[model samples]
Target: MDEESRNGGPDSRQFDVSGAKINILSDEYDPTVSLISSNEKWVEDDEVPRKEVGTSSFWQATSNTVALLLGTGMLALPYAVMLGGWSSLALLAFFAIMFCYTGCLLGSCMKENPLLTTYQEIAGSALGLRGRILFTIFFYVEVLANRVGFLISVGDNLARIFPGVESHIPAWIHLSPSMTLASLAMLLISPTALIRDLSNIAYLSFGGIVTSLVVVGAVAWTGTTVVGFNQPIPFANFGKWRFILGLYSYCYAGHPVVPNIHSSMREPSKFPVMLMLSFTIATTTYAGIGLMGASMFGKETLSQITLNIPRDLMAATIVLWTTVLTPLTKFPLAVAPIATELESFLPFDSHSTAHYVFGNIIRLGILGLILAVTITFPYFGSTLNFIGSSITIITCIILPCVFDLVLHWRTIPKLQLMVDIVFLTAATCFAIVGTFSSGGV
Candidate 1:
């Protein structure tokens, strides 16, 4: 290949894909020069630097990473375990470890070539232009669907909180609990979505973490006390384990964003430490919340653990409010990527008034479509399953392992290659089986 094609030219930006740095010079194709040179633009435009004066400290990065990992997924764990049984914990543990490992692989790719900023960029690097396009398509579909799921979640919680309102609202108004909450959510998110700077909404990301903690804490306490854990502690039946494993895997759906998070770290080498700490905390919390809810409520455990709890007004209010507010805060951040990508295609100066006006209109239109989807088909489980089977597995497991092997084929040890093959095969199988089990396929 010509130098320009190999190095990605001047416009080519690289971010760290692998957690560890790779010495690409030894290879027939030298990736180091292009990777390093292209990173300059990304470093300048990255959200982290715009949000703050400098790269984030370990703790700051940790907080954000943890917040990203901990979310509405926690609420569904109990139901996952209820379906997969206790065996699901083993699957959860396995997936968590693999998730972190694959994350490290992405990090290593970044380390080798710190310029690769987005998942799409990394995919492009690994599999060339085709890979980039494929990843972007999946990324858009997965995230849009996820956003719809978030709307559904917010609406569901709101319905629970105000069960009476749904009854009172006229049928002619077509204001079911789901529709009403989704409409309100879209309204709340529109203004935030219009803004160009993601840094402005940094504070809102914490809402997911705070709300998650409250829900987990409430579930743990209530599970032990009011519910009186009469259900089996380590309940296991392998029959429907695939279904449960799929949901559990869905909980660790933070891999796509890891490179961005890693790039923002002040100490990039320590990114693995940050990854482990965040995953450990998130996984433990998920386990505790899921197990407790399942042990207490048993077969009765609902998709959201809070729903199964003895209805104390205060608890219900707090849980439900957080559910709404958490996603409320996350809506902008979640949709920002989509808006940014869509905005890029418009032929207008980003700084121009026309751009801002048009951008917001497009963003609102996107949100309107998502809201419509939620209203039309408000099934959260199917969305979760689809994401888990498709993007989650591809981004988290298959792509990472495959990229590592492909990028460093000659240098990496045979044993490591074998392991990657095993993991890739197994994870692919899981994705397929999980999809079928979850009725996604």
Candidate 2:
């Protein structure tokens, strides 16, 4: 293939992934997110360099990486265990390990195709043109749906926090003014539009984690007494099918983010470290939060979390942070799909006013749609399951390994092949069951 044909994006822009330095990966939560922000141009800051952010420190990346998948998913994890039983958590741990291995595969993939810009590109490399078309088309659509779900949840959560605001309007305003405003506001801050790369988003990501930890701590203290730390952690039953499926689904949620994150760095040498660190922290956080929720509330756990604990001051703080920062989660999700779509036509568009304006309009629509869906579901489990499960299956489990193997199958190390088999098998089964269980969600 000619260099230009191979490199031209749908928009006809050069693929531009020249270095091991990271390209952008859009957010995992895509459906209802704003895409405009994903196009923001980055200007390298010599004064504040990569070394400042751990200089590719695995531990540092690990800390942020764990927090990456730690949001809304953790809040519901404990309850999933309760619904499915302790066996669910045990099963989930295996999925976590599997995802981490996927993370390693992704890291290795980056080492080879440091310029791989999107999941579709990686998939194309693996299985050829058909794979790229299939991967990109469905992936973007699913991301679009997820952005909608996330916006709705944000509205529902806001209403829960501010009864006054809810009273000022309808009790169920998933598509309410508040959601409209927040989504619009986020559209304005398109991370994609920002000059910094994916790592730059890490700045906000770290801050979000601090707030989440505080909330986790608050929930932990108020609820569970940890009556049995040594209570023979139950042996997992992968045979239960449904429970195993759910856990695997949760762990694989972070896989779609690999290509861009891996490629967008000074040195891809430490990509595996980032993935391992991220998953390890993520698993521990999920377990702790899940254990606390179950031990404390057991069957009584509230949907979308019953954080109605009576800490007026702390509640206000967390509510503010979650509401404000939470909106940002969908920014990358919004950006990725639009970027893909934009590439499909009129590929020469750059950072003109027309680009941002058009980008913002799409962003507003996507976010508005998310708010609308939440109005209907109102429950976190439903949306989380809906967007979370679909994306998790396509991007996280099946695609990553398939793509990696496609590109490197001729000489893939035996060890990597085994990891690929385990994750792909686990992901495929979970996707099949998730389709059935969440068919109507």
Candidate 3:
């Protein structure tokens, strides 16, 4: 049963925040409470208890975030190798440090301000509401585009393997239509329903992690046979470490989800450990698969390439469909929040939850935009690099630390600013290089 049907009324929970009853409601329990002034903060006043952080569990959270990213992009890992060769691992290590650093800083902010749900809230706290909304919107736009590309790319691999139902339809129609339908169906469902609790889906994450290991293991076994350990390395402007850093940045963009995960964590301090483990797992996962792909396919074949390098159709199809499953699940959940936020201007009566969910055509419209972007910008590698680098640099890397330093400038020690300056400087360099390299210059 849904939260409404189960509770039979608005579900809420009261937290004593400075002697005020902060009644948080909804099945999703994502508190909509916002501070209007020092004397007033608005929270929904329903009789129902607040839903616990069940859907965003540590294992599942770790797995889903890692899996969705690893699936589509890890397929492109070989291309990174193709671009800069084995030495690229140096840049990868550098990014690992930065990833953990940013994750820790973001986590600290979340711990300090537990109510800060959106990165927009974090930004808005210092940069004003408009700035917060703009950055959040820009970040969401990139995420949506990336999600679309992920589905299309998965379809591309599936097409290479399945070929067709009857093997009679034209390539363009056959490919795009089926994938679009699959994406649409996934989006139309309520993520709130699919995962009422994370523990319910914890098995899915464990299953996904095992599947990833099996798939990558299979690839490693095959790739090792063909290319061995000593594959040819490229010298594509070796001096351009900045662009290389940008490429590595794309492979590790799950830092934003840290806040969502931290909110659920039993011992939030363990969050840094979890985040690091997640990144390490992701890095090793992608590097292994990328190495396998490059060993088997070489630079020319692997660039803008996919996971369809398998000779066995059955194996390839299974990997293609299953690898993208988590990303497919993430699409609707991520999109719903955007739609809900647009609820304020929605031309409908204020009190209809059904209308808010169903009446909005804007969600479908956003999906259409995603499809258009994937078709027009068919080259996935550079597009992924550029978007991932630029947006993540701003949203994940630069923004939080900047906000912390700026808003709490006087309270913060001088050492903190120096550290942020170094990171910001590094990120700027990476963004510049990533943009140019993505342009094929």
Clashes of each: 20, 37, 7
Over 4 Å off, model 3: 1-71, 113-118, 164-211, 224-230, 235-246, 304-308, 324-326, 350-360
Task: For candidate 3, give the lDDT.
Answer: 0.56
Off by over 4 Å in 1: 1-60, 114-118, 173-175, 346-358
Q: Which candidate do you rate higher for lDDT, 2 or 3?
A: 3
Lowest lDDT 10-mer window, candidate 3?
31-40
Stretch of 10 with least lDDT, candidate 2: 27-36
- Candidate 3, TM-score vs. the true structure? 0.73
Q: How do the residues 215-274 of candidate 1 rate in per-residue lDDT, one tens digit apiece?
A: 987777776557776897456767777666557777888676677677666677898998
Candidate 2 lDDT tens digits, 1-441: 233333332333211111111222221211111111122122247643121111323453445355456655565665665566676776677777766777676667656654444565566667777876676566556555555544554555555555565446555645555454444554565545333133344334334466567667766655543332222323343444353354335534645555545533335577776676667777777777766666666566544443434435465457545744554554553454455355335333656666666655665555555545645555556556655556766666677788777778789889878878877886787777775665332
lDDT of each: 0.70, 0.53, 0.56
Model 1 residue 43 lDDT score: 27
Highest-TM-score candidate: 1
Supply candidate 2's per-residue lDDT for 429: 72
Candidate 3 residues 335-414, lDDT tens each?
A: 54455455446666756776556534666655656666666665566667777577766666777678777676787768
Error of 3 at 54 (Å): 10
